[model samples]
Target: MKKPLVLIVDDEPDICELLEITLNRMDIQTYTAENIRTAKALLQQKHFELCLTDMKLPDGNGLDLIDTIQASPNPIPVAVITAHGNMDTAILAMKKGAFDFISKPVDLAVLRQLINSALKLSDPVVTKERRIRHELLGESLSMWEIRSKIDKVARSQAPVLISGESGSGKELVARLIHQQSSRSDHSFVAINCGAIPLELMESEFFGHKRGSFTGAVTEKKGLFQAAEGGTLFLDEVADLPLPLQVKLLRAIQEKKIRPIGEHQEIPVDIRLLSATHRNLAEMVQTGSFRQDLFYRINVIDLHIPPLRDRKADIPALTEHILVKLSAVNKIRPPALSKTALAALQQYHFPGNVRELENILERALALYDGKIIEYDDLNLPISTHNKLNCPEYAPDFGSLEDYLEKIERKAIILALKENKRDKAAAAKQLGLSVRSFSYRLKKLNLDS
Candidate 1:
């Protein structure tokens, strides 16, 4: 068998010699290039399993090399070397498609681990396993961008913080990330940080001994222990109280957790993925959330756009929801009339995907026909008023077009009246959450 080859690109002779020596000891053949110009030439002549380059080079930076490689028909996995403590540059490199990064004055242990991970990409089995397709269920441009980011971020061990409105499926995004990562074989424990009681937060997170408390009849494993060698998703992480924040920070930084009433701390290995709809930066400014903890968890941030923002996906989402609802209920799924769909496309959905499901479930229960009509929808009076308003009239192509214009105006007015709160606007408009969401998309009124 031919030995796996690695390409090393660095301007510094000492660094090149050091990496070559280290890799050679591992029986990995290496080709060295003192600049990007030489590295490009070597890449054209060789088939390397991996490439490691320094961010700063005499001819060009690592980013330039990454771009050149990525533009090629088949690009090799590449890692970059950044200056010590240059987290911003490292993150930029990752976003630009670098496999991973090592800081200058790098530890050989970390370097070896990075190389091994990059080489794993060459294995067809590992590549297939790491590309777990996420069930995000949207074709909007925003969703496509998110999927791309997920694929890239899954390859790294960095902490990721997902931000979006309530019911936007942040947990689903986290699960997809876990599935696509190297930790796919391990457990994925999700915890609702807000649901746990203040007194029991620590115990729930770090577990407890049998005799630790009055109700402790058996030893319990906390989320950290339960999620050992896996991913721990803390949903609504901003809800954690100040005291628990300190403990959480310690565990994250030290990679050790001490259960309640336990003297010894247990070492834990976990990839932390946290999410919240609330503005954490604002919370930090107001002294509600810990800044240090915020910085720690938000190493690579991803924001999911609200359903209202991606109104273009309403039809597809509705179809998916209807299919799932029909399968579970063991009933023939009803087809939505154009008017019914228009009603949904025009209304603003404040509750997002959850509200959409709620509206559909309610409609399914009330209507007993193969086709769901506009009247059968039982939409709010606000939507009707939009069509019947005696205000200034515009030149209409048809009655349907006029009603649509009216609905657009009414939804926009309701959104403004309610300070853009989808739930409140939906309630005030007398439309179901799903109807409001659908209408928002139908009329292009969602912001």
Candidate 2:
């Protein structure tokens, strides 16, 4: 069998000689180049499985080489050799489509690992068929751009910061990236950083030794250890307290972690992906968040557009949600009338997709007819007022009876919208908790 070939590009002769000897020892063939001009000449001559280039070359920087390689019809996997502690340049190279990066005075173990990963990318077995495609489910221009970026970033090991409002599916974007990456076969551990208690955050993130502290009855694996050789998605990462941020930065940069009560540090291989609805830049300016950690994690940003921006996709999203709701309830999925969909599209969804799903679930359960009309949807009165009928429609019978019916309908709508939480519904309707409870009983809606 022919040996796998690699191109080593660097201005220093010592670095080139070192890399050539290492590759030869690993049964790989190497073609060496001293400058960008020679590297381009060698690249033009024949195919190579991988290209390792230094960031500061005599002719040009590593970014220029990355662009040249990425623009080719069949781009080979490339890694950058950056000077130690210069993560900004490393991040720029990764953004420009470098497969991965290593720092100067490279450890042989790390170099071998990087080379092995790049070789896997060049393998024919790791083809498009192997990629697991998850549905993002939208056809808007912004959605198209998001999908394109996801595909591009999935091929790299760069840390991605997903920014969007709550319920906009930032974690879903992270999952899609992991599923489509070379790390798909491993665990994708996701944790909401804010959800963990402040007292136990360290143990939760870095694991704990048995009997290390109170309530430590058994040894526990932290999220980092659990996601070994895979992805760790820190949802709501902005909520991480300042103290833990420093430790997290070290673990990420060094690729090592020391669990609570442990004397030795364990090397962990994890692809870090994080998300936040809060503004990190603002938080950094205010000293509430670590600026260094912010820069480290925000190497690339993926923005998820709010649901209101993609109103054109509401019909399809509504249909998909209805189908799932119907399957769970064992009923035929109801279709949305044009007016009802228009109401949904017009109402600014403060809660984004999550709010849309809740609205559909409530409608699916409560509406009796197969076609959901405008009146059937329990949207805010502002939307319902456009084509409202219950108010203006005349009643020939007792006036008191009509008024009672209207009040009953309004109260019932509030309860459903608030998920049967009487207190919240009362607040929405400008009533005290006691008054709301009395009204629910009076209308016989408490049943």
Candidate 2 residue pairs that clash: none
The candidate that achieves the highest TM-score relative to the unseen native structure:
2
Q: Clash number for every model? A: 17, 0
Model 2 misplacement above 4 A: 1-3, 21-27, 210-218, 381-447
> For residues 325-399, what per-residue lDDT tens digits would candidate 2 score against the true structure?
889988888888766776687767768888889988778767776788655678644453522324322321367
lDDT of candidate 1 at residue 32, scale 0 to 100: 96
lDDT of 1 at 302: 97
C-alpha TM-score for every candidate: 0.70, 0.82
lDDT digits (tens) for residues 212-302 of candidate 1: 9998888989999899867999999999999999999888765678998899988776778999999999999999999988987887899
Candidate no. 2 TM-score: 0.82
